[model samples]
Target chain A: MREEPSQQIDRRAIRVWQLNGVVTTLVFAIITATLYIVKGQYNWPDFVSYITYGLAALTSIYLLVAIFVVPYIKWRRWRYQIYPHEIYVQRGLIIITRTVVPISRVQHVDTEQGPFLRAFKLSTVSVSTAATTHQIPALPVEEAEQLRDDIARLAGVDDDDE
Target chain B: MMNEMRHVHKLTIILYVFQGIKASAWSLIVLLFLGAGSDLNQLLNLPFTSFQLTLIILGVFLLVLIVFSWLRWYRMTYQLVNDSITIKHGVFIRHDRTIHKRRIHSINFTQSIFHQVFNLTEVQIETAGSDLEVDAVLKAIPYQEAVALKEKFLNLTNTHLVEEELPIDGEVEAVDEEQVEEEQPIIKEKKISIYHLLIAGATTGRVGAIFGIVFLLLSEIDNFLSEGDYERVVDWVSAQSIVAYFSLVFLYLLIVIIIGMIGYVNRYGRFSITRESEMLYIERGLIEKKSLSIPVSRIQAVLFKQNLFRMPFSLGAVSVELAGGEKDDKEAMQTVIFPLLRKKEWANFLKELLPEYQEDLSEMNHIPRKSFTFKALRMTIIYFVGLGVVHYFYSELVLVKLGVYLFALLGLYLLHRIPAFRRSGEQLVMQYFQVVMLSKEVAIVKKKDIQALETQGSRLARRLKLGYLNLSIMNNFLGRQFTLGFLSEEQLEEISEWYISGHHD
Candidate 1:
């Protein structure tokens, strides 16, 4: 926990994360609005309106946090480094997680690009073992591809069964 | 070697028909609820009565079902090639599956009442992969043929030299039981006696389930009785003397115990484990007898688990985690090697049955006492939230508050004792409590078997110099994860470094 991984994800990851946060906040806003509409259409009790108000307040607070606070913290904390025998990754906002995936146990490595990532020229590299998948999100597209290739080459076709 | 395709036993059609009926039981119930014997006949403009119409429809449905079952039985065939078994089945869309002898992880045989009546057996073959479904199923085969098949496959590539001519109907000549018996290099064998079965049943800890079922039945009975009758019954109960009430409670407990015993006996009455040929053969069940052969190489880890009742008696169950198999509703990805054993017997049991997993687990490193602060704080928050919910429902019960606090204290105490780990040679022995109450497990996993090692920490945990460790290991298709929280950051680093460097200190 004292030392961090050697590398950080693409700086543009902040924008991507902010976009994801915006979409989540929008979904919450829609849910709160629906609750309000339902409360108005039905002869709901007073507590129902209070619930709607509380939900709206919470959603707004989440929206502010998502836009201004989360993306930067997430971008700053996300780190990864590839060693000869293992891959180390550090991530998460509230609960920081450090993961070690042994290279010999790696089953496959893949690079993925969603619309937002593609627009930002970024790709997410996911390394899969037999049981779990670890992802380094929002890396420069070429760098992500190179990382995937490096991991796949280093993983090398071990004969042991998972 | 069976180079030609052969059909299963002729009883498969009958078995398939019964299976179809069982599968469509919901629709049959719905039809009965529709009640074609009633005034619905008047609503229909047909010449025949609704009852006769219903009968005619049912007869046609039965005919179709019989035809489908026959077709399914006719279409299904299997052939054993040099190193693989190829199965082709399905009535409409053909399914061809080839399972290599080397890849087969387990061969399990199940005998249902129907199979027993007809002297047939159902064979299931499992392979290592991501698929949750059994790789191949040979549904209704002669009991002797099933045994021979299991023996042959479990023997792996040894039978290539004995390429005996196949019989005319493709039925495997039952290998002489005595001849095959001599070939087994059995390392150890253990069988549960009737006395142990009774003890296991008594300590199954399923009294809660029996009580729940009884309560559900009583509540359902309320629907059939009039309110006045219900009140009279209640009044009669309330009017009983204290001795009678005590007797009633005693009777309820006796029933619970009896039911638990019966259930346990039925499931594990004839349980046995035999170790031979780099495989562990497990056979259990009194009526629906099931025999499973697990290749020792495929086992990912060994687990020793103790429930609350079993813990008091120093009894625990031993199970092994394997990668791919049909999702068994009862035990999921684990196969129990020992349903009940004394705590002291575990070392000897593993040494004899699975020498690869035998390791000294006497000296486990406990987490720092400071780690308990985070664990206790988390438990307190959860306790307060649970108390809030319970208080919302029943505010007048002071005993509820007292019980909740006491329960919370017990949980914190248990948490205080858990999250211990030790590395020995190439294996890590982890001991922890499950999310459920009073159940603890210790897993002995090889370093190579672990998929990933993860350490996580929150701000509070960081301040306290504590972290959580999660280890992933393949179990079924998706795998199972074990989490141990509230470890010192240095301990977390040491473990992670050991995993990465494959070095033990």
Candidate 2:
């Protein structure tokens, strides 16, 4: 018996990316404190804060690359099974929520890229229904376009004119 | 033709001026009060001369603007032809809005006491778009002409023209236009009456009066306590003695009954709903009589509401949710339909108004009995928890407050199981969806207007193989929330299938 793909979404991975959040906070705090010290407003107690900040900075650098960069690289290897009946998209570290959009209710599909995403040559695909909008962010530009076209074709909305 | 265009009453400008004056006076009073209460008098302070000058300038500007507005309003004209209604107005930027007859959803006529006295009516033409209201004051258009224009627009002859012209492949159009006309349905509609209006007034107007009285009593209680002398208060209380209280209560009840009567009389005074070949014609209202004609195809949803109070009287109101019109104000729903009907009459009335949904209604499954218990339990828990928290926090400030909370909890518990409910097949049907805390609504939503169907399952529900189904419809006035909870897995699947099939069909 073949287990449904829903099982994959229930699994968990250590979210090392959270350390990047801590590092980013530390970097911004250090920059602000350095500016304050240069202006002669820094206190010694506050100055000692940079020790924890330095530790966070070092750990975050490793965590960021391990979590974000590695995921982006490995995401290509990950496969999403899309069928006429259902679609399953899976990619996450800690918490995972697998969203299901029935094909019959799909109204329209859009592919867009931001500046950061453009630099990465990646795009986001958003599926819009009358009631709600769902998105799959940061796919390869070509793959995103293909997904959009496939979804549109499946939804019976002709994108040939566009 | 411009010269002959009927201007709104001259008093209309006077009414506007009065409104502006009232607004300005209230603002000045509030400012004075704030200035006196706070130490910010300097900010509001003005020398006598400056104050006089400011008032004079403001008054002059107000007067000039009022006169200009009146002139422009008086110059506004509207005309109804066979195909459309046209409104023309403007002082600086001339605006001529023409609404095709087919696009019109409803025509509303309003007559205030002043308008009634002047025998003038304000005609409001509602179309589908949000920003459009083609309104013009008809300076006494013969009631007959207004009725005739309404009838003309309600006739579906114009709608059929477009439908017939559309090309159909491999289909023989054997029927001549005359034969087709002959084959078109002629609906026999009932006329509203003084009695119906009385019933509407009794039910609707009495509720309004009760709320009004409660509001007045609450507002005046502070004044009665703080301002009145002891003797005066005693005198007032004495005036409300047992006999006096009973008499006053009786009189209030009588007044409510009268108002109900008046509401019915006003709304259904000359009510006549007729069908003229593929169109529904409704002529109603008293002082400012209105006539509306709606095409059969344009009907979006039909709703019928029955209240517990109205049940004994066998009075219900039916309203059609039509497409391509701005939603009426929330209060308008009360007087939107022919009011005060018996439950038995609903089936026949609905069949006459909407024959398409009759089969669907028969196939509807009743909400499971367990669902009501679950709903009741949920409501009870929410109410009790909320009550307990409030009492724990604000025990001192709340008045008769614990008793009130207990009473409210009791009321919710009772009403939760009032068997207020809904059922759906390939179509949507809901009964006693709450309108207010006290009132319930029953409506039939068409399948096409349903935008989406969502099935949600929580851990408990998933374990039990039960889920909640929500249907989102296009009508905003009806609100977007339609929850059917505690349905079995099979029921959920069936509901989804029904929703999908209905939409496609």
Candidate 3:
């Protein structure tokens, strides 16, 4: 059973991933720069003579492609099938992984907005079960709240024995 | 009898002083021994006349300090009001503390050999937090008052005598003083006698004590041999024939069994269990007396275990899992229920204690017959591979090692498949939830206690829509881990749903 308009998660998650990639690259750049400066003081070698510089360059390129391009493509292909009984999330880059969480087992659902996400007016939804926790990151704030209420209502009702 | 409550037996403080002196003496001796090889002779370089004087002066100083500490502690006193137990002590600090009866999860009373001789008891109340333990409520309260206070605290309904019941916002109305007095029962359940101690000792605690002794002996032997004399000992043993070796092994096992028996008898020398309306009380100990009471609702889980050796004796150990109970240093499993029982009596006892979980056993699911081949093959292969690695490393002794490998592999294969695993709908009805690892433990936890559930898929399982479900529960000290493995995806989902529904309810 599917809703009339196939439910699509907010596309802001792509931006969140892209931002994460940029922040990670900056952190590595600062660390590498410090090491290179330290090596120069010790007369070790130039930055180009170091193997780590080449590895860092490769990592930067990989992160750029993965963070921006991959998540965007996946988000385009992603489809969430949410029903009264269960919520199924399907998305992947190369190999698709589908997770089905039953509403009965949903212990609690939280809608969190970090400073960065709040600036973008986006919220992350986290659902905790007895044994696992799942997150749907960077949805529209309004949509995340709706999803939280719907899950809570579904969990509150006792329909299993039937 | 009332006089006993006011003054703690004089012997307790004396014993404390003695113990402190012993510890201090050991420390000084160790320091002196370590200093013997060092260039510290100058610091200790005293004239013979001065050395003798110094020794005498130091000894007197130590004695005075020990006596002072003992006297300060001796004056410490504690009393149990209707709702709270107050402890007041400390020579300089003058610390005064009170623990409410309602907040206390378990009350444990311990009497060491010295306390026992003086007819005194030490009571400890365990509360919810991790930071502090209320160790000395009444260090040497009269044994009878200790028992009465223990019973009073254990019975939740008799809260008026301990403390005025805190007013709930909207639920319980305050009761009058007359009603509170009427509720106090003069005679509580009689203190469990020494007989019950034997039963408890014969079961789990005794077995643990035996194992501890064996471990200690083994370590001592290792130490002695490692000191460069082991080669000589080994040469002497090697002079014996193969038959002699076998007999020596047999003798070792016999000695271990005898030690186990002694441990059991000593620990459970005087076991007793009495049930009040609100709690189950258990008291057992030989030289060191132990009394513990667990409330009915606070009991989280109950577990039963039966090893192959215990099968013949028709004996099993039943342990209760409760929150806020002191975890033993050795065993992580917190048992608040009956510690041991005959298998036949377990069903009746469990039903009496926890009627909510008692269910028809036939409805439970045993491990499917189809799963037997998988389990057997997996265990056998693991054993073979492990033995193969050992063999490869010690190829110089291949023949003898090969025989050992074969024997181990066969034994493991039989153990894995013979018993067969079983699970009831949501509740574990039988003693079958054991993981066949280094130490096998059977756990029976309520669905609500499960903290998290995870389903992992391999490449193949991902395709087949089948995966492994790992259920993590909060372990007292270890934080959280799981009794996890492969299961049918559908079954995993159903179990997850069941746990979720249970939590919501």
The number of the candidate with the highest TM-score is 1
Task: Kindly report the TM-score of the first chain in candidate 3.
Answer: 0.84
Q: TM-score: which is higher, 1 or 2?
A: 1
lDDT of 1 at B180: 71
lDDT of each: 0.83, 0.57, 0.60
For all the predictions, what are the DockQ values?
Answer: 0.66, 0.12, 0.13
Superposed on all Cα atoms, model 1 deviates from the true structure by an RMSD in Å of 5.1
Best-to-worst DockQ order:
1, 3, 2
lDDT by residue for model 3 (B1-505), tens: 1212244556657766766668788766765555432434356665545445446556776778777767766667665565677676777778777787667777788888878877888777777543334434555667887777766665645554424445654434345554556665432343323444344444443455566777788768957666457877878889999999999878876776666656665555556666555677777767787877777666555666655545456665666655553654234455635545666675566566555555443343433343345545655778679868876777577677667766766665544432322345565432333543222334556555555445555445455544444555543332344443344555556665665454333
List the candidates ranked by lDDT, beginning with the highest.
Answer: 1, 3, 2
Candidates by TM-score, descending order:
1, 2, 3
Residues A7-56 of candidate 3 have per-residue lDDT tens digits of: 67777777776777777778877777777777777887565446567757
Tens-place lDDT per residue, model 1, B64-183, is: 999999999999999988768999998889999899877877789888888899899999888876565547888888899777777677754344323343433434444434347656
After superposing candidate 1, which stretches have Cα over 4 Å from the reference? A157-162, B34-44, B47-58, B156-184, B225-232, B377-407, B503-505
Best by DockQ: 1
Per-residue CA lDDT of candidate 1, range A55-103, in tens?
Answer: 9999989988988999999988899998877889999899999898888
Candidate 1's error at B116, in angstroms? 2.4
